[model samples]
Target: GLPPLAGFFGKLHLFWCGWQAVLYFLVSIGLLTSLFSIYYYLKIIKLLMTGRNQEITPHIRNYRKSPLRSINSIELSMIIYVIASTILGISMNSIIAIAQDTLF
Candidate 1:
């Protein structure tokens, strides 16, 4: 995920732990892979924003016009999940403290 998302923090924490453990090679490899993944993600986002997928556009338009285009339970759940994750990411330090307190 992006900077404002949990995935970014999770990866960052993992890399930090790896560094603390002296796993330099593993950390380097992970950082390299993350960079490649970010590059692809940005490429995909650019393609989407540019509407380069001509074939899918028509299908998407048709889907939007369909009566079944109404938001379903699955979409609602996904929206809720995104909102919750964003909130959790923002409050992650508190969550880590809570977990450490419970675990220790």
Candidate 2:
């Protein structure tokens, strides 16, 4: 999440400079990587969803049900962190200013 957050701001700064050639190249690379990631992630999710308890190992199937209650909280926190970082990247100008000041 942090890496993506940083990348979002970096790309935003690049685009803001009106460097069309570099920006387009970087964006194309980003799109290709994103598609690759989506493909693998979806494949893993499909594999997990399609599996039956009978097909899984007995030790894994014996897992406690208590952990299920905490999954909602964990997912909620992760979602909030992602949303907050995206908002920070989009609405805050200080990050771009600092990055420009330091990197240039």
Candidate 3:
């Protein structure tokens, strides 16, 4: 996920914990994999946003002016999810406190 997203916070906490525990190897591996996954995530986002798939046959591409038609509901939900994740990430300490209270 992006810097402002929930996944970034989750990974950050995980890495911090690993560092605190002195698990340097695991933390390094996790960080490396997370960085690698960003490329794939961005590629997927680009495809969704652009509605174009270069892998598709030219015949099929020509058949539809837009290869991937936009769905209003999906777009709306995506927007909502992104907003929620950003808000949650910013307020992560509150969430952690609540979770700790409930768990303990």
Candidate 4:
């Protein structure tokens, strides 16, 4: 004879163990990717900060030796955007994880 409520018990266990675990897994992956992006942005910032210059260089009003030419306003805005996206993305994903935990 089949036991009564076996299916319900099984589903409850899966919900508490399997789905919860998967939510955490996805959150961790998102966080790791965000951190990696942050690291890459910092590396670029460092390269731009410690670049070389010369006194006998060609005449120019604003000179930047980095690969992307001088650090213009647009470049600064892009760097800021990349940094902000990384932070915001991580935070939003974390909030989602928390919400899921609270809901279920």
Task: State every prediction's TM-score relative to the real structure.
Answer: 0.56, 0.33, 0.52, 0.30
Better of 1 and 4 by TM-score: 1
lDDT of 4 by residue, 24-52 (tens): 67556655665686577666666568764
lDDT string, candidate 1, 1-102, tens digits:
579987999999999999999999999999999999999888878888897765355755455433576886667899999999899889999999999999
The full ranking of all candidates by lDDT, starting with the best, is 1, 3, 2, 4
lDDT of 3 by residue, 1-104 (tens): 58998779999999999999999999999989988999889887898899888955687566633346665555678999999989988999999999999999
Each model's backbone clash number: 0, 0, 0, 0
Residues 1-104 of candidate 2 have per-residue lDDT tens digits of 12456665775565556456657676667666767876777666676898745655677677654654866655679999999989997977988898999999
Candidate 4: global Cα-lDDT? 0.65
Model 3: CA > 4 A from native: 56-104
TM-score of 4: 0.30
Per-residue lDDT of 98 in model 2 = 88
**Model 3 steric clash pairs:** none
RMSD of each: 4.1, 7.8, 5.9, 16.7
Looking at model 3, residue 3 earns an lDDT score of 93
Worst 10 residues of 4 by lDDT: 52-61
